[model samples]
Target: MSTEENSGALPLPQDDPVVSAGLDIAMRWGAALGGPEKLKIAFEALEPQLKREHQLRLKQLDMQREATARAEENAREAAERMVRLAQQKRQHALRMTGLWLGAGVSFAMLVAGVYVARDMWWLSLFLWGPSLLAMAKLYTLRRSDPGDMQAVTLGMRSAANAAQQAPPPPVP
Candidate 1:
């Protein structure tokens, strides 16, 4: 440190009644800091650590945001899957009801056709043909659709299925 630069930098406050006021206080503080150049160097030296901490905080926030978004997306997808499964179940119930009704009607007609066969053979044939077709359709229909409900985690479901399918333990 140069003697001229270091000598008498920050003057102590005088023991006078008159306050040195704003400019005087500022000059004293600036002199205590050694100069504007050293102040600049101090700030420059501290900036990298401050900047790194700021970036780290921002990265943490971004990670949290991304995780939340992924969770919401997974929830949304699960909800959609549930809705689709419910719709499919509703449609299946409706189809099964219709098919059961048709089967009942056809079976009734077949019985009626047998009673009518002895009286009017041609009329019985007319009723029998369509009844047979309806029965055939009911019997040939597939019970399950190709697109069945898929679970993300089948832990409980698989356990239940296994329990149901496994042979009962011998009564001890």
Candidate 2:
């Protein structure tokens, strides 16, 4: 109640009588309980439980880390499988296109050779010879390794060049 009694105490924003009364009670209780020593003993009793809880939390964190790593590895493997499947599909399409083109060209050349044989024997030889050579080249291409990127690129370039040299479609 006197200023001397509150000297060492911090100034309260509001001079609440109830707050001062509660603080006084708390100080008395603290002194009766042997102050810091009782609190230290309470904490020491709780040490083992706190350590067990900490170890459990660390184990949970480790498990979560392992799960994340496994998930990432699975995702990576799935992505790789998708890429490989796409490459296989592309190679299959190219092979099918090559087969169809080779068959059509050979058939067309044979028909033309037969039609031109009686009139121009030399033209027939030219047509049939080129068709045979083209077939032989295709056979060699099929026999070669499909995994070779350089061979695949060369084949694509040659096809592009042949397309460029081909005559344009007649206007409608």
By TM-score, who's the top model here? 2
Across 36-133, the per-residue lDDT of candidate 1 in tens digits comes to 67767877899999999999999999999999999999999999999999999998898888778777777887888799776555546655664355
Score every model by TM-score: 0.55, 0.61
Report the Cα lDDT for residue 104, model 1. 79
Clashes of each: 0, 0
For this target, which candidate reaches the highest lDDT against the unseen true structure? 2
30-61: candidate 2 lDDT, tens digit per residue: 57777757857867898999999999999999
Model 2: residues >4 Å from true position, as ranges?
A: 1-35, 139-172
Q: RMSD of model 1, in Å?
A: 20.4
What's the lDDT for all of these models? 0.67, 0.71
